[model samples]
Target: MRAAIPARIKLEITLSYLATGSSYRTLQRLFRVSRPAISKFVPEICDAIYETVKEYIKTYLMKPYSRVSLTKEQKVFNYRLYRARRIVENAFGILASRFRIFEKPMACLPETVDKIIKACCALHNWMRITSSNNYTPSGSLNEEDIDSGHIRQGSWRDEINKTLPSIGTVGSNHSSNLAREKKDRICRYFNGEGAVPWQE
Candidate 1:
């Protein structure tokens, strides 16, 4: 029954919920759906979205041609795309427990489903923007990971040498720089100086 929902919406909601840590019951309440239906819709949506876009995100992996062509101007876009996926992937645990939006089997006009999904996604993105400031590392490993080691940025040498790499892709090296820059920017923007190595 719940299987009738389109896969795109399911994926968007899954990723958004994961990013925001909102729950099925809460989602049910917000969307007016039953918890059972919420449960039914989430995973299938996630799978559908992954199946749809998995190939488009090859730059996030170690694939060779995925990284070589990126110029500095496009660095930030690639960084955000790569990091968004990483964050979404990492946030799965948070999504499963924190967010399960099954809000009372939402009664929506068929035309407005897109609006709901976009609204949710926008809200999720805003939360992510704010999350870094309020976010606390839950584990010692995460704490250590912050200072693991600097990845010296110069070439696609390591990326290419990896079992599979993103060497030839556009903005690959630039994306690396963007990551470092994002770390610094986030830390500085949030006044997390000294606490985050990126700030120093």
Candidate 2:
């Protein structure tokens, strides 16, 4: 029987695939592993990586209200929320730019895709913490001019925009009473004590 592939080699193959979005055939040639073996082990490694790093993942779900609304306070609230959302989007853009896998949709099961996303996010966080200097060099992320409040597009935007299409939200239009109340309270805070001079 053929010798089993080393664990380290399998990890390197998985990371290479994630970072480049390479095809199985391409990876087989690059890693000298059979296509079938690469396909089988990639998902397994992703699941392992996600299991190891899932604790670092946190998500906040806040959907902005429609633009048709009036109220000055509501408009400000939306603006602030939009600004915060842009930061999250920029983070994704950075990841997509560096790890080309996200630039295109993965042809995997939903659960596998979920594992891949969590694994990539975990890797991104790890790199940011351990190698911030090289991982996120200057001009690689969106920046706002402190004086003018104008957003300066990051270098990642140019690459991500070329391939990543915008996707619309998929959910009901109606908000629950509790959700509405929470949103109102947050809005009040933003307009009141949490207000920043630059947010005007």
Candidate 3:
């Protein structure tokens, strides 16, 4: 058997692949490492990160309740959940823009792709927390003042289409129905026992 590659080299290769979406052969040429070694360590490191943070993932990704079971107040709470989805999408957009690898098609197995994404997300959150001063979104407002009573507009498409869609939460599949149901339940919980005094 060949000698083992060092952990530092493995880390650099894995991160470079995730940041650039470079093919294994390309990475092999660039890093002077074998394609097999690159493939092996990248997924291994990603899986380790995922396993380490699985609990946090579960906590943040709780399922939503269905809409059919929602009360009027519960429905309003559910609407807030829908609004929160924009935050997730905005985070994704920021991640993709920062790490161009996500912008390109990932030419790997689905499981491997998931691991890479999870690793990147974990790293991104860690970086944001540990080094908040170093990173700023390009052409956006100063990151420092974002949370300082500044109203940020999520989109500018209202001028293009003032009318809202006619449909009202019609799902095309059982999974969608289940997700809606979960949201409604969460909403009910929030508006009732889960609510805080400060919430309007």
Clashing pairs counted in every model? 47, 0, 10
lDDT of 1: 0.44
Candidate 2 residue spans exceeding 4 A from truth:
169-178, 198-200
Alpha-carbon RMSD of each model: 14.5, 2.2, 6.9
Name the lDDT of candidate 2.
0.84
Off by over 4 Å in 3: 53-71, 136-172, 176-181, 193-200
* Candidate 2 lDDT tens digits, 56-131: 6676567676768657778788988998898887888878887888877788778778778888998887787778
The TM-score obtained by model 3 is 0.67
Point out where model 1 deviates above 4 Å: 1-12, 56-200
Question: How does each model score on TM-score?
Answer: 0.29, 0.87, 0.67
State each model's CA lDDT, in order.
0.44, 0.84, 0.66
Best by lDDT: 2
Q: Pick the candidate with the highest TM-score.
A: 2
Which of the predicted structures, 1 or 2, would earn the higher TM-score when compared with the native?
Answer: 2
- For candidate 3, lDDT tens digit of each residue in 1-200? 97789888888888788777688999999989998878878999888776765544424454334557866676567556655665665556556655656755677889899899888887766655666456333433212233464545433222122332344566753465566677567777778788866445
Model 2, residue 130: distance off in Å is: 1.8
In angstroms, the error of model 1 at 27 is 0.5
